[model samples]
Target: MNNQHDPLSSRPLVSSQEYSEVKNEDFEETACEDSITQRSPSTELPAYKLRRSAWYPDMRVMISREVLAVHLVWLLILAATIYVLGRFTPEVKCGVSRLPSDVVFGDIPYQIVNWDEDSGFVNSDPLDGKRWNQSREWADSTDWTPWDDIHPGSWVQVAPSSKLGISGGIPLRDYSKDGSWDTNDEGYALTMHHQIHCLGLMKHVFISAERNEPIPSTSFRHMDHCVEYIRQSIMCYGDLTLEPLQLGSSQKAIESDTWGSKHFCRDWTALKEAVWERSTVGFDRHGFVFDKVIP
Candidate 1:
């Protein structure tokens, strides 16, 4: 018989060689009483490959559970700090108010029609008719209608972000030396809309100069100076009221004489008087005009 094929010939005759008897001391004496599997105290598990995330480098070091948790917490804190810093940094450019414009002086941007005076110009539907109500007037009302939301024709589009070519907020309505008399909110005084703030100062300075006399178109250098002046003057308004909302004893105490003048109403009045006196004496041919409108 072939030894490879014959089962009896291939198997060993000695049964004792294949099996060994365990000593009674080697086995747990109390295993049956406890009813639990017996395991050797010296046994060890085989080493296996460790898996890791692709983003993190596998730093081959024996790490404890507490150590690994600490590392993860530190990484999370670092990521959060970077995110917060990016939010506050001014990445995109924008102005506090309207952007600078290319529109120069003497450009004749829009036409003004005196609606109340029929004899002056032919009345167009828009510029010729009684378009607004004149009954509601604020005590500290100014000639400018820039902030008046009621009148449809008085609002001019402003590029507050500086992306648009326009410099500052311009009221849609215009009033000149012509016989245009209407309390209907058709036009605004030059200083009406220039709020008591640092923003839109270049436009305010230009308007102020234009109202005073035959000044040339506003220069870029002059605008820079005006912006600095406005910043210094109007910074106080952030904490307190610079311009009063109405006219009265209480209003006079809080409000400015001119809307944006840095000085208080009482002080601005004194300054105006001084300017007028100087002009009258021919010390200065033209003095600053400080006119506050009250309605």
Candidate 2:
């Protein structure tokens, strides 16, 4: 058999299945003319341009309304700068960090100003009234003591049986049941010399306490009404009984010339040295002072 021209019938016809059947008949005639140019509805898109660039708005929609009006003008300028810094600021306050006063005041006798007016209290007053019975009867005839060199308005005398001792809270009456008045330390120095003769008999002088007894001419008229009540109330008045001086070496007492003739005063050693020098300046033992301060 003479193989017809051999090499698989002369190898010259290229095909790949006739070039895939003419590329599938030219892609079905270009999809039938692109579906007759999209069904020929005037050949394209239009119904309001197929309505959509994000449903009709443009330049990135005014760049999203200028980014929401610049985030609502930066949230209304941060809420009007926090309402104008809460309507014009300024309320800070803060204080309290203290510790520095030291305490000074010197000359003292009366103007203390605080810590309860140094203590004697004249202000909040009331601690057994009549201004503490006229400041303990004007400190019993303007108190004085080195055992009694009587000084301020003097007129000493006192004696519900002497040796003074009525410390404040007064009420130790029983002047032997009934004589009502007498409360010790010579009936509290004759009720503080009748409340210093009701505070206004001017030039101090009090003396009244001779309920009876003792002589040397009524102790020289009770020592001449204590040297005419310290020579009509202070500023000067002397005579401290010349001699028997020594107060400690076992106590002694015999120079009593009484007030006017000076010397011999001891309303319990002048109200215990004017209640320890008016309670060490702050004035207490009834003078009342220790002022006050408390936020």
Can you write out model 1's per-residue Cα lDDT over 162-260, one digit (the tens) per residue? 332333432222322232323332222222223322233344444546567354455456566666766666674453435445565765555444334
TM-score of 1: 0.20
Q: List the lowest-lDDT window of 10 residues for candidate 1.
A: 280-289
Q: Pick the candidate with the highest lDDT.
A: 2
lDDT of 2: 0.34
lDDT of 1 at 236: 40
Per model, how many backbone clashes are there? Answer: 9, 31
For candidate 2, the per-residue lDDT at 99 reads 15
